[model samples]
Target: MTNITKENFDKAKNFYNFDTLYAPVLPGLKATVMKHQDAITDAFYKELANDEIAAKIVAGRVDQLKATHKVWMEELFNGEYGEAYFNRRYKIGETHVKAKIAPYFVEVITSSLRRSFAQILVAEGAVAVQAALAILDLDAMIIIGAYHEDRMHRMSDVTGMNLNLLETLMSFG
Candidate 1:
């Protein structure tokens, strides 16, 4: 795993402008997000069920994935944006990569959940655009960070093998 420094995490938080305005509504956001968890998950799977790629990725495991996804949604709104939360997000991303799931599926599913969350928040009269966007942005960044890290690691291994082969061929020469 690529080590994400606290500085980098803090930088991201600041870059997203997740400031005092965002903190006040954390509890309310958590409640709202939790309340609509089922709807969000259902919508997510409904969309995935129609997508050939996504359906293939989740074939025969819809029930298990749905349960796991529910937990992920709960944790996302757990109101604890610490190292553990970040690590969980990173692992979720890494899991998708390792499972050979395409990145587009991840984006589509997450976007759906975000939209659901925004609608719930708006309906509850707690619309904070910056706060909402910041949450989504932070989650996206962590997930993408994991994906990039895994890709780079795989590429590095391939590069090393190529280099070793080149060195062996040059020795033969």
Candidate 2:
């Protein structure tokens, strides 16, 4: 296990507070999200479709998949990042499972956006660092939530795990 010193933990914790020294930097984050939303999503799906695993899983429903995905993407630019924001993300993950999409695609989406965001940030002058951090943190949550849902659906398919199991696992993560 890695040991976390108080100073290090405090630095990490402060990264998400938005009201800290890093507060002003978050608007840049919002700008980045808004500026690249469609391009990022389009690139993500293209990368996803090229992958054998994702292509097979999401073959026939690209439009529906992109529809639900647009909702998830819109939240990033909605300018709210409190408890409600997180709940909505988890809900998106659940929606993906309902639509029969695998959770792994979430990672695919997040990683693709991160790469795109990184390139944009580098060209964004001094404000990009904080924006990049915020992107990293938020994307991690959505990706992991989707991954959790994927696991729940897989378990259910293989072992006949009930709907309750899926909901319970979703809630836990």
What's the true lDDT of residue 169 in model 2?
64
Q: What is the lDDT of candidate 1?
A: 0.72
Runs of candidate 2 with Cα error greater than 4 angstroms are 1-15, 19-24, 28-35, 97-103, 142-173
Candidate 2 accuracy as TM-score: 0.61
lDDT of 1 by residue, 66-147 (tens): 9998887766655678778888888888888889887777776778766777777775565454466567767777877677
Best by TM-score: 1
Inter-residue clash pairs, candidate 2: none
lDDT against the true structure, per candidate, is 0.72, 0.61
Error of 2 at 19 (Å): 4.4
- What lDDT score is found at residue 117 in candidate 2? 70
TM-score of each: 0.81, 0.61
